[model samples]
Each structure stands twice: as structure tokens, then as C-alpha cells.
Target: MPRFSSDGVDIAYFDEGAGDPVLLIHGFASTKEINWVNPSWTKTLLGAGYRVIGFDHRGHGASQKLYDPELYHTRLMAEDACNLLAHLGLPRADVIGYSMGARVGAQMALLFPQAVRSLVMGGLGIHLVDGVGLPQTVADALEAPSLDDVPDAMGRTFRAFADANKADLKALAACIRGSRQVLSREEVGRIFQPVLVAIGTRDSVSGAAAPLVELLPDGTQLDIPNREHNPAVGDKVFKEGALAFLKARP
Candidate 1:
């Protein structure tokens, strides 16, 4: 684990394997290991001859914690990714992001398009425009004194997951708050890079795939049949679809 200065916060990241670079951004309440390693994402990318890069966003994983909601904006997280690339001396790289990470990836393509060669946005769909899947209730759960205090099922599940991960609850609360910011349809359409939007057929949080794909200049969707958000993270369909898209990029 290495640390770097991103917008004044010390962010932790991993750079492994070798070849064309592929940056991996994990989802909400997830670290690089949980999102990439446990799911074999690093293995998949490395086997495809890609240099894998991953990092903990502010307030998540081993990164510096920030309790301010203003600091948790996905745009700021996107900047952290760009800065990580700058730190690695990579002008551009293929990018993959799941759940919360997908929003950050979309922001990266929107705000720093030159730094993204191609984009794979997973665990996300029309939610990019319709508003974040989870409501303010999830944020409230993170701020609750204990998981038991979270009445909402989805909120409780996220709170428990955060607890299991030993996450900074207050910081994560802020993350959930600030991360609710959404990209407009016009903004999403502006991300002209070849994009693959992967989501599970059974995933309700991600919303519909067709609406998102309709906005991008070069976007396609891959639905993992009978899968949901959590289980779809490392699905072979997702990995294979992503690898194929990357290979097809000129």
C-alpha cells in the first residue's frame, strides 16, 4: 500500500502487474481489496495483460478520512483518480468502476476525458441520471450509533458491511451525502469515449441499462443474467464483457 496527496488528503493505492494501464475504482463502503482482490478483478485484468491500479477514495479503505460532506463529492473522488494517474506518470488509461466507483468513473470521463482511454461503468445504470440508488436513509444509517439503530433494510446492510470493514462511519456518512450528486443527461452524453455499462439483470439499484447507453456516443450494455449488485461484481460475464470492450478499443 502506497499513499499520495490528492486534494490534500492522503489516498492509498496499489499499482500492480504490467502493460496498458487499467485503473479500478471500488464501490461505496468498499476498499481496493474487497472490491478488486476478493472479487478477482486484479487477477482478471492482469491476466489480460493490463497494468492494474486501484485506490481508496477519501474516507474509505486506508485513505485519509474526511467527515465533511462537501469533501465527498464524486467529482473530487474523480480528481483523486486523475491525480493518482499523474502520480504514476500515466497520461491516460482504461478505467473500470463499480457502484459508487462507477459514478466516479463517469465524472472522470466528464471532467477529465483526456485521461480516460475507455470506460467500464458497472453496478450503475440510469441511476447516473435518475439520482443515486440509495436514499439519504443510508447516510443516516452510517451515522447511527449502531447497526441495530438502522431501521431500513438496505441501510442496515450497508451499515453492517461498513462495520465489518472497520470503516470510519462518520466519514462514510459524509461520503454517502456528497456522493448523491448526479450527472445530467447532457453531461452523460458528453462522455464520448467507448464505454461499456455492465449491470446485473436482477439489480434494482442500478436502474435500466438502455437509458444510460442511449446517452453515450459509444456505449453498450452487458446484463449479467439472474445476478444482483453484490454478486455481479466479479461475474465472469462482466469481466469477459469488459475485456472484450477494452480489446476492441482502437
Candidate 2:
């Protein structure tokens, strides 16, 4: 693992393999390893002859931890990604992001359009406009003394995932709070890059892929059979569809 300063915060990251770059952004309550490496995403991309770059967002993994909700805005996280690319001397790259990572990736496509060649919005769909999927209580769950104290089902799930990752609770709480901004249809439509919206058939959190796909000027959809938000991240269908999209995209 390597570390770099993004603006002022130190971010932990890994740059592996070789070929055209593919930035992998993990989900909320997830790290690069859990979201990408452990799921064989890095392996899959690398095997396809693509370079892989991944990092722990400021409040997650081994990156600098911040407690300010204001600092965790998705745009800021998107900036962090841009900075990572600038740091690596990459003007642009393909992006594959899941859940919160998907939102961050979309922001990158919007704010740094020239820096994103194409995008795969996995585990996210119409929710990009509707709002980030988790209930606000998931943030409250991060504040609970123990997982047992989180009575909300979704809250407990996130809390347990954070605890398992040995995450900084206060930093993640702020991230959940600050990263809730939504992109309007107008905003999403402004994204000019080719986009792939991949969601699970069983994903209630991501809304449907069609509506969001319809919003992108050049968007397509891939539905993972019998999958939910979390499980869909590692699905074979997702990997194949993503690889195929990458191959077909200009």
C-alpha cells in the first residue's frame, strides 16, 4: 500500500498491473480490498489486461480520518479521485464504481469529464437521482456503542460492515452524512461519457437500472440475476458485462 496527499488529506492506495487504467471505487462501509480485491475485481480487470488503481476514501481504510460532515461531500471524494489520477500522472482512465463509489465516479465524469473515459455504475441506478440509498439511521448506527444497539436492519448491516473493516466510526458517520447529495436528471444527463448502469435484480436500494440508463446520453444497463446490492458487486454477470462494455466502448 502507498499513501499520497489529496489536497491536504493523506489517502492510502494501490496501483497494480499494467495497461489502460481502471479506477475501482468501493461501496459505502467498504474498502478497496473488500469491495474490489476480495471480490476478484482487481484480478478480473488485470486478467483482462487493464491496470488497476484503488484507494481508501479519506474516512475509510488507512486514509486520513476526518470527522467533519462538510468534508465528506461526494464532490470532495470525487476530487480525491481526480487528485489520485493527477498524482499518478494519468489525465484520464476508465472507472468502475459500486454504490457510493458509483456516485463518486459519476461526479468524476461530471466535474472532470476529460478525466473519465467511460464508467460502470455498479450497485447503483436511478438512486443517483432519487438520493443515496441508505436511510439516515445508518449514520446513527455508526454512532451506536455497539452493533446490538442499532435496531434498524439497514443500520445494523452497515454498522456491522464498518466494524468488521475496523473502520473509523466517527469518520464514516460524517461520510454518510455529507455524501448524501443527489444528482438531478439534468445533472446526470449532462454526463457525456458512455455509461453502463449495472444493478442486481434483487436490489431494492438502487432503484431500477432502466430509468437511470435512460438519463445518460449514452448509457446502457446490465441486470445481475438474483442478486442484491452487496452481492451484485462480485457477480460473474457484472464482471462479464463490465469487461464486455469496456471492450466495446471507444
Give candidate 2 misplaced runs (Cα > 4 Å).
none
Clashing pairs in 2: none
lDDT of 1 by residue, 1-250 (tens): 7899996899999999999999999999999999999989899999989999999989999999998889988889999999999999999999999999999999999999999999999999999998775789999998888987889999998999999989999988888888887899999889999999999999988988899999999999898989999999989999999999999998
List the global CA lDDT of all models.
0.93, 0.93
- Candidate 2 per-residue lDDT over residues 10-107, each given as its tens digit: 99999999999999888887899899999899999999999999999889988999999999999999999999999999999999999999999999
Model 1 residue 85 CA deviation (Å) reads 0.2
Worst 10 residues of 2 by lDDT: 127-136
Candidate 1 clashes between residue pairs 3 or more apart in a chain or in different chains: none
Residue-level error in angstroms, candidate 1, position 155: 0.7
